[model samples]
Target: MTPSLTEAVAQAWPPAEWRDVHLLAAVSGGADSVALLRALHKLKREAGGRGRLLVAHFDHGIRGVASADDARWVAELAEGLGLECRLGVAAGPPPASEQHARDARYRWLAETAGEVGARHIATGHTADDQTETILYRLLRGSGLAGLAGVPPHRPLTAACDVVRPLLEVTRAEVEQHLRALDQPYRTDATNAEPTYARNRMRNELLPALRLEFGEGVDAAIRRAGQQAGEAQQVVGELAARLAGEARIDGSPDEVRLSPALLAAAPPLVAREACKLAWRSAGWPEQSMGAEQWQRLYTLLCDAGTAGLQLPGGVDARWVDSIVVLRRTSAD
Candidate 1:
């Protein structure tokens, strides 16, 4: 028998000790999500008043009728289970980029959670996704923060926290569970296409890796992610402290960093502190890249660089020992 997702979630969640907790299960009509919804339904049935279980789905408008079909299938599933279902459809042509689609999906999920007064949004991110994510981040030359693959839970919006109960469960296990239950799920044809990096990784790279490295790759990577999270905690604490120390009097749109303070911190600390300052100044987290980090780091370490240009039309320059970050004129 497959271990229960509800059991796993019961152990890690109820983010607060509220008696009645509302959860919005994000379903995409895929095997993993179908299994998750079933498991949540089981949990909800076993323990009444553990709050309500709701379903949310978003159509990216990319796969045309198929995407709409997924939304309908999810709605039917929710109806069959007697749960409220919320649907969000992208109005315009869907963005071609995966990240854009993901962003829109998450925003919709968060927004739906808020509307339903749910405190948490649950997703079907399994260990296979975790392995793929860490490998992808590794291939992308991501630092520890990015390498901290698929967090088990994190705040999505002010009102909702996204929880991944299946982070330790494999996709194979999810498929197996669905099969055992005689569950039907929609398959996205794009998943098998080689055009997408994740598809290539899942279809080709992972199998090749398994052949070379053996079946323990998933376990090893899971351990690595856990260790990375522990490590990130320390780094995050340091970054927070450094961000406080580096902050100087400035307008909300501007963040002034003490160059000497930043330079004195460890290299990683300095980099994260710069990111902290950048975020404090109301810039998006993804706005910074390697070049942006290097530019900011150089500005801190060198102290003589004329100015640093960042993504999102942001700029940074030094006034003696103080580093100032401000929105670009165009912004």
Candidate 2:
């Protein structure tokens, strides 16, 4: 037998000493989210006036009838549960790009929560999702930050906090709870498609791994992510301290960094120092890649009075005692 949704929530988020916090739950009329709603409702009641709950649904408008139907189902469910429901419609089809859609969805959620005076946004991300994320990042050779996977709580915006209460619950348990309660949910057809990397990993890679490695693959990956998260936090703090020590400030178009200080720091610290300089010079993070880093480092150390032009109309020049990074007007 599987644990009830309430039992799962209690295990994942212990109620003891939990303070009152305004929460906005994101529901997609899926089994996982519906189960989360039920569990949170029960927790709220048991807490005896601990916090307020709000339901938010987004219609991506991908499937003509199915999308609207999902929005309607979520709204009706929220109504029956006696929770305030906030509905939003995506102006058009969410971009084919997964990262773009994710960014847009979170932006919509953050905006809605802010408008409704909600302090936190709660998402229904299960342990399965966390495991998949960790595996994907590992396969992609992601840095320590990517290895951290999804955090339980983080600031979504300056005003709103994002919380994941179902991080420890498996999809099987969520489905069982919803089925036992006779609740219906909408399944997105696209989830079954193999074109997307995540879907391919979920449907193909994971099953093969499970068949060969046994059933503990997900748990092992999650543990690795937890350890990586801790290590990344420590590294980030050290990098920030080193950045402060090597501070060189200038206009957004022009950034200056001390060559001697950068050369003296560890390779990781040097890379982070250069990343900070690029960001301060108004260059986005993704714009700097391995080759670009190599060019910048070479210019800073070997070739004085020389500059390299980066993609995005940015230029890095070594002059006097500092390397200056500037964005060209054409960028």
Candidate 3:
């Protein structure tokens, strides 16, 4: 049997576990978020709250009046529930792209949460979102880690985490809960726009696939994502250990590794370790693709004579059986 919205939320994050933490819910006046906020409020009431509930909304102004309306609706909704609301409006015109808008929203959420002393930020990402994310990453040739889709929780800062209480709940369930409560929500027309690939996928591709293969397609994909997540956890732990063990010498701008130690590990492990190294040095990885990582892995394993330059002004070369990755002046 499909779980009710409240049951789903409780299953994902029990009141007993989080009733004492200051949580900021990221609500965009959509059905999923509205349901999430309402369900959490109900749980808190039942748990006899020891903590505070905060609502946060970021208006990107992409739709001008509609965008502002969303922020207003979220604030009003929070106010009705007697919860504090934090509203952030983009300083300039709306962001140029969807990615930029998402980035801005998150940055604002983090900042707002810090100001309000929230230890966690909860979002309304549902199971359908997870399936869409997994399919999108698959289409882009993402690796296993990418195929794992959206995580249930992740650290946004040292003291704060972003949690998705509806990760296992379906959008249909959210709408059902909202309908039961006679709650209203804002619908973003941009979600139906054809210009966005995700919109196209959600409207056309997934629906068409479901028609051909039945509803089980979504379940199968979600299962694959769950399996991928489990596998990635194991791989991540090994990579972290390998990265730690192989590091022999390092400075502020450079990291040195034992080529023999790296070569001893599996290719995938070594490659992931290299990624960890890049992150530790604060090097930009926006342009590093599968091919670039593979090249670095090969160089590390083979001790190639030719030195190669990487993105973010990093250079990789083999020196006396040691792999030295240094930040150069040139990109």
On TM-score, the candidate that comes out on top is 3
- Ten consecutive residues with minimal summed lDDT in candidate 1? 187-196
Write the candidate numbers in order of decreasing TM-score: 3, 2, 1
- lDDT of each residue in 1-331, candidate 2, tens digit only: 3346687687667655343767798988777788888888778777855667889987767677887888888899999999999998877656676566567778899999888888878788888889998888888878677888999889989989887889888888888787887777776623211237888898899999999999998899899999999987776676677767666877656777787887777766676677765665556767667777777767766655467888778777776777777777555
Estimate, for each residue in 201-296, the C-alpha lDDT of model 3 and write its tens digit. Answer: 888999999999999999899999999999888988999999999987778888898878888898888888999988988888888888999988
Q: How close to the true structure is residue 87 of candidate 2, measured as C-alpha lDDT?
A: 93
Per-candidate Cα RMSD to the true structure, in Å, reads 3.2, 2.9, 2.4
Q: What is the TM-score of each candidate against the true structure?
A: 0.85, 0.88, 0.92
Model 2: residues with Cα > 4 Å off, grouped in runs: 1-8, 11-19, 93-96, 180-182, 188-195, 298-306
Candidate 1 local lDDT, residue 227: 88
True-structure lDDT of candidate 3 = 0.85
Better of 1 and 2 by lDDT: 1
lDDT of 1 by residue, 176-229 (tens): 888878889987723211237887898899999899999998788778877887
The full ranking of all candidates by lDDT, starting with the best, is: 3, 1, 2
- The 0-to-1 C-alpha lDDT of every candidate, in the order given, reads 0.80, 0.77, 0.85
